[model samples]
Target: MILKTSKEILREITLCDHCLGRQFGKISISTNERRGKVIRNLLNCLNPELSTNFNKQKPCFLCDNIFERAEDIVKNISPDFEFFTFHAGTKIPEEIMKKEEMLKEKYGLQYQESIKQELNRELGKDIGAIIGKEFKREKEDVTILLHPYDSKVEYVINPLFIYGRYNKLVRGIPQTKWFCTRCKGRGCAKCGNTGKMYDVSVEELISELFLKETKGADSSFHGAGREDIDVLMLGNGRPFVLEIKSPKIRDIDLQKLELEVNQINEGKVRISGLCFVEKEIVEKIKNTHMRKTYLAEIDVCLTEEEKRKIEEFFLDRDIYQETPNRVVHRRADKTRIRKVYKVLTSKENCSSLEIYCDGGLYIKELISGDEGRTNPSIAELLGKNIKCVLLNVISIEEKV
Candidate 1:
């Protein structure tokens, strides 16, 4: 059956050793090139009528003899970036793929391997050996795409993710870059030709130094949660991930960079516990809702009886909040149920209170009630008109 099939396939079309062996790939543990050679030798001995066809020196009808120049194709590729692991892919010509498919369908070849799979494996091996890098299927630092027909090579450099905690010591800056609403990032008089609403953000203050060191194309800032412009992030700080895209250098000293960033930003913004992380950490940081501790200074002075009532009333209580009037225009007008873990009164200041609650609860609305938008608020409980003069995030509990 094998000899009969080979005789018929060879008579119809010319296939190189690699292409011929790939058709019966599942039948043996050996390579397709070796299998092709063995089958051809057997046919030459058993059938002399097809012997002249073997020495015709014709290009493969399937691959056009691209496999013969595998070494030359991979040797020409030189990646300038630093990477430890790489993955390879090929963009085979559509005409070649169609021809191979037609042959498989006509012969009813069930044990065939795709041209793409063989090219990826064979080219990946040669690329790894030539460049002195390991070939990886998952989490590769870089990807090399080989265009066999065009003799062109393309490289995709994966983004580098860095995890750390940041303290926004000073207020009046957004967590991320806010483009000018009128111009939308294009320079105009509205943004003083800077194309931004604010002069600097927590993202710019931190990511600028990283982009400079790594020589990355661009960056993205992913914080656990963002604080308002006026609110200060104190104590242990907030967790964030900085994604640097197409980085030319990855082996950066995080400890050294952290120190330099803190010194440059000074009292305005500071980062700590800087370390390298995978891309998965970004999603984890964004998805996990953490409990936060806050210190809010209110306008109304709380009496002794009122202070005691406020603390007891908020313990383990659920607060229903619609999107506050201030942010309803930008955010969806939906109600969110959040839990208040604990509430405490300040020892020296009668107008100050410390609130411990879930991450997304609006502390300002909790104090003022946002004109009845938030239920069971401090103002509603005390039956007075209260306003939060200032708010500060003291700490955030890390996820277990």
Candidate 2:
């Protein structure tokens, strides 16, 4: 005889349980695993867990008998992934779930279990019990995406990024990624078919070693402003953050990592403050170039008589500057009035004077006077044609 409606039986059974007792939830099977068999044998067993112990019932139409294999699913999915926490995901067959829903609408499955709720409870407990990892209802490191069709599981892995500052003692490297002017990273005769304009850069030199060590797929370099290839990065070296993608190894020794990166450059580029920073650090590093301190090694064609006067004038003052023609091609041509908050002048000799000023002051144009484009330039102030012999970034400061 066809069993009573699922609604009627489920109301009597309460919720699903172990054994053949609850196969009434699954229409595909005619009997519960053990409950049906034992209840059939007893013919008198009555448990509140179920309305009345049944000798026979239907199988789970939604989950097949796999609900019986919840233990197996947990065991197989647990491995090295065990130590880390995880969240359970149910991959119930759409067709199966729909069939149950249809039967419920037509016949009304009042107390019948839902495939989702059943899977969540049964699998969550079993998986958590096996690996000592809990099925977190909140944040989860591991998400077990289940596929019912192929019985496949996909685990999503998170990425880790490390940040640091590196000083390129070498003068030939660009600060960030530079594509081949000839072929743009694509092989071509103009670029010797290598597609790279430069053989290497500060980013590559630093990240290459890290990529190799961590076995990550790729790396990205972020910095505030870049100096010309010919200029030297002195003082503390330009601040930078190197982001490593998909790194399998996260527990790296910062001090040793710093040593490793420095060793690769062989003193040409030295990296320090090797610490783990988040993606937000990259944005901060670029936007926080508000104040840059520079030391200008100026070469002067001044007589000994005029040197002291130049020193005194530079000792304290608010110098105004505008965009220099040299950088007009790359930077926007706009007049910016940056304050010379502090100035420390050193008389290298009668021929040259070293000037140190607060950050954001363009020292190069301050020397040449930007063709009289800058006011109160050292050249304009001294009323003599003077030039900066060399320029160096002495230090950079920001509240970390």
Candidate 3:
């Protein structure tokens, strides 16, 4: 009785083999098309009257024979990609879905999968067989979008992240590239028509080398903190990340690349501890609250007694530093409280001091007192004039 009723239902409606088979998809570990054939064969054995009509009728009341176009789409996509893994997805029309749901409810097929899911799986199987590649649901290199109008292939290139520490060996070099003041990167005689204030920068040196190695289009530089153009970075160097955009090649020899960069920029800039990283490292490094150590050589018009007192004054004290006049044009005029952990003075050559403070503390202002803008500064403590002639970032603590 069940077999006779199924045959009557098949004869009544216009269902393609795929959709008809999907009505019984959960019966066995077989394809919907195969199940449809099996069901039709069973119906024929049970009922001889409707055998000829069952073999002749061919239509799908739900999809309207859309599955027949899967072959054409597969052929069009076979030569479109050269990727290790891919996934095929479909965007079915609302009307087709409504018809499918209507049929599912009418036939009480609550356990069967949707038409779109089956189509995507079937298409992926066919394409995978031809291309000899596995299907990746997540982190795919390429995705094939199948629509009623056309099929489109999109390559999903993952961004490459590299984390390391860099040393700006020489002075008068900015962390990132600076455009020329005269032409503003448009090129002018005042800047030697190079459109740059400096011939090279830390970003340029590291980014160019990375771009070459990865065959990437471009890159973005993220540093834990920035140092002035005249400040040299020393010690274990400063942490940074290089985000490569649209890299064609991902597997790279980081150690060899690091060696090449250090060799090329021998005395200018150098990077160490090069390693492949994920995107999350960039944000974590940027928002770090690591302590900083700076070595500043200053010229103070103070006696030995005053210098001694000034060095001991900044130890374990809080400074209310307002925005310095020099950077007031760009930075907001506001006050910020910073902590000074230690201040060590050295009178060997030109009166230098190693100042350790919380991150984001303006060391230059601390020495100059920014004309009394910064309270309890070295100048304020000594009650005399002081100027930071040369500054060097000695070390930065790791926070990420």
Candidate 4:
């Protein structure tokens, strides 16, 4: 059957050893080129009259003898960036693919492999050996794509993700860069030519250092949840992931970088528990909801009885809140239901209270009532005007 198939195929169109063997790639463990050579020799011996057609004097109809120039194709790839693992891909011309498909259909070849697949494997093996990098199919640090016919090569460098917790020690700074509403990040007189609403942010403080250390092109910050500009993230801090794009260096010492960042940002922002993480952790950090404890200092002083009543009122209580007026312009004006688990009064200050609540509860609105947007608030319950003068997130429960 093999000799008969080879005789008919060679009579129809010329093929190189590599292309000929790929038609029956799944048949044996030998390389396709070797298989093609053996099949051609056997066919020539059996039928001496067809030996002239089996000559390799012409380009292959399927691949145009691409396998013959595999070494030259790999020579065009020279990656400047560092990568430990990589995968190879090829962009074959449409005509070549169609021709290969037509031959497979005409012969009913079930064990055939596509030209792209064979090219990718051959190129990957050669490139990996030449560069001293492992060839990986899944989660490779980089991918090399070759447009073999066009003589073009492209590189895709995957982003690196780092997970850690951060503390916003000082207030009056946004979690991320806040662009000027008037100029929309373009420099203008209203923004004093800075193009931003604030001079610095937690994201800039943390990401700038990592980008410099890794020699990355750009970066993005993903926090589990953010706090208001006037609020401080104290205690253990909040969970976050920093994604660095096109990092030339991946084997970074997280401990050394963490120490450097904390020292530079000192009183402004600090990060801890810095470690390498996969990209999937960013989604989990954003989606998972954990309980948070906040300490709020109110403007009005409350008596012992008033404090006791306030604590008793908020125990496992569900509070309905419309988006606060301050942030309604940027956010959707929708109502959210959150639960307050417990409330405790501070011994040092009669006006201060510590509230333990769900992740999304609006603490400031819960205190001031947001002009009836938040139901059963401290201001409404006590029949007195109240305002949260100072707020601090004391703790955030870690993901289980």
Candidate 5:
């Protein structure tokens, strides 16, 4: 029944082997094009008039010979590609697509593939074979857009991720670059035509090195948590991932890059454990619970006995802290409970003491009491006015 139907179709309209075989692709004997050639040969032996009148090499009436251009397109674009995976796509004329639809309806062909899909598949296979790359259906690294006169090859360079810890040494530099409020990154006179509020940032110091090495178009910095602009990030530093976008070069010597970045930005910002990682690590680092240690220097008129009492008050206690008034403009005004696993106090002077507390606990608010917003705070417990002179993140203990 299939062979007879194929011969009848050949007698009625002109179709190449691929188009004819595509009709019976649902049977899955082999490839549709091969099955089409097999059917054509059998029909030629049975009916000489059909073979002479409607040649198998002739342009398909439905597709209009568009599929035959795949090879020439591949060979032409071969010199421009150095990609690993690709997706092929084509734009066919509306009239040709409508004619194909009409033929499908007339022949009651429910199992046939569209000319566009078959064209992409055929071209993708041939191109993949020549380039020694796989044809990807989704998340393609490269995309070949085929049109009648103009064709384009687009490269989708996947983001390169580097996981490490960054130390922000300065007191005034922000973790990320702050664009000018006046122009919003477009150069303006208010920002001195720099398109930035500040000339230097932790993100710029770290990501600039990577952008130069990878030859990437842009970059984004993802930190586990950020410290205030006034606060210094010391000790082991804070966890972060620098996502390099559209990186032409992925293979890099991370150890050497780390050394170069640190040497360039020596006293400003430094990165450690510089290694390549997957994109998912960015989300993981954001969502994961991390325990941190901070060293806060507070100035208060307290004696040795009073400092001991302050240390005893915070140990193994849950500090009910409301959002500080300083950050209320940006953060939601809500009370949150954070655990103080241990509190270490050292008397630097008669008016200064260094205190170490757990992560997520607002150390400055704990000292000042934030106008009675933070409960069981050092200021509230000691009944003394305490002000944080300097705050620094000493360590960040991340869960494996």
Candidate 6:
């Protein structure tokens, strides 16, 4: 620090408060402003004081004159951004950093700090004070941007996520609207340019309404698992997360979203226990299959008396199921052994029964016996064939 004079330094290099201060970064500096001031003050004190006090205003090379207007930049952008927390994203002119490196060759520059870190600290502190929001570094909902030269700042707001559970009361429509398989959503004659197999889906009904109400451009829906279009999902529904892209309003009532979504679906789908959540929860819900219960109306080809044997197999049994023929296209033809958690006879005379157990259990294959793919199935145990007439997801259980 004592090796160079202010006039010599200013003559050799032009440095802003941040750039000059950063050169002494390893000096156990407390704050960016303090470091900037100290570095300049060292030059002023160590060297003879300037006649016109121009040394005090020596511009930072890396940050240009950005440090001179740090407070003004933070103040200018705070009005538009109103969040409980914020973080700064700094951008330094690349040439300025390079120039500092070149000057370091001739003069002794030690313990330096980066102009970017300085701007981040100074702007973050000043903005945090002006608005009572904390600087959330980990998962900030809003980010503050500073253009130190022109004292310009911009704010970026993160997307909002809402979590909820949905129950599909009726069938026929898919969990998510299906794109036309023939056109692959490109809108051929089959899809009529709508590019979908159906007009709308349970997901669309809820997400569309959310986008409208929240003034959001788009919304994405994520569920724990999806049931087939023909299958109905019941009981505690399914955990889902809906991300509102560029949400203009975050204070909307969840109860209202639930009501509006359910109403739009016309009772076709029901939602409950809705709440706002962080984006990370969506991932948890997607992978957590937990446990599920299914109720299927089995159509037995057996006589009434032979159907009675179905109960005996359910008392205690393990069923080996190869991926069913229907899903074989997507899933590998591998065998899986699952236990029957419980069984309830819906109609003894009709030879139909309900089975409850873990999720991902193939119900139709269990009844038809999956062409001998499923061992110890109701059809196999009774020594007669059976088919599932109506399959319904009765409930899904997760750790609340």
Q: What is the C-alpha lDDT of each candidate?
A: 0.91, 0.63, 0.80, 0.91, 0.78, 0.72
What TM-score, computed on C-alpha atoms, does each candidate reach? Answer: 0.97, 0.67, 0.76, 0.93, 0.84, 0.85
lDDT of residue 302 for candidate 3: 50
Compared with the true structure, what per-residue lDDT tens digits does model 2 show for residues 1-400? 1133432444443223342244344544333445445444343344345444432255543455676566666666633422255677777777867866765575554445566655666677777777776666644545676653455666764445676666767667788767777677887888787677777888888888777776666888888667767657777767777887756555667788788777767858888877877677788877765455665666655665566666667655777666788878867877766555445554554543445555556777877798977777878877777777666665666454
What are the RMSDs of all candidates, in order?
1.3, 7.5, 4.8, 2.1, 3.4, 3.4
What order do candidates take by lDDT, descending? Answer: 1, 4, 3, 5, 6, 2
What is the alpha-carbon lDDT for the whole of candidate 6?
Answer: 0.72
Q: Of models 5 and 6, which has the larger TM-score? A: 6
In candidate 5, what are the lDDT values of residues 240-326, reduced to their tens digit? 999988777767789999999999988888889877777788998887657778777777667888878877776778889999989
TM-score computed on alpha carbons, candidate 4: 0.93
Which regions of candidate 3 deviate over 4 angstroms? 1-151, 180-195, 301-303, 332-335, 347-350
Comparing 1 and 5 on lDDT, the stronger one:
1
- Pitting candidate 1 against candidate 2, the one with the higher TM-score is 1
The 10 consecutive residues of candidate 3 with the worst lDDT sum are 51-60
The best-first sequence of candidates by TM-score reads 1, 4, 6, 5, 3, 2
The collision pairs in model 3 are 14-61
lDDT (10s digit) by residue, model 3, range 112-194: 66888888887778888877777888766556676743565445555678999999999988998889988999999999999
Clashing pairs in 5: none
Q: What is the lDDT for 152 in model 5?
A: 49
Compared with the true structure, the alpha-carbon lDDT of candidate 1 equals 0.91
Model 6: residue 130 alpha-carbon error in angstroms? 3.7
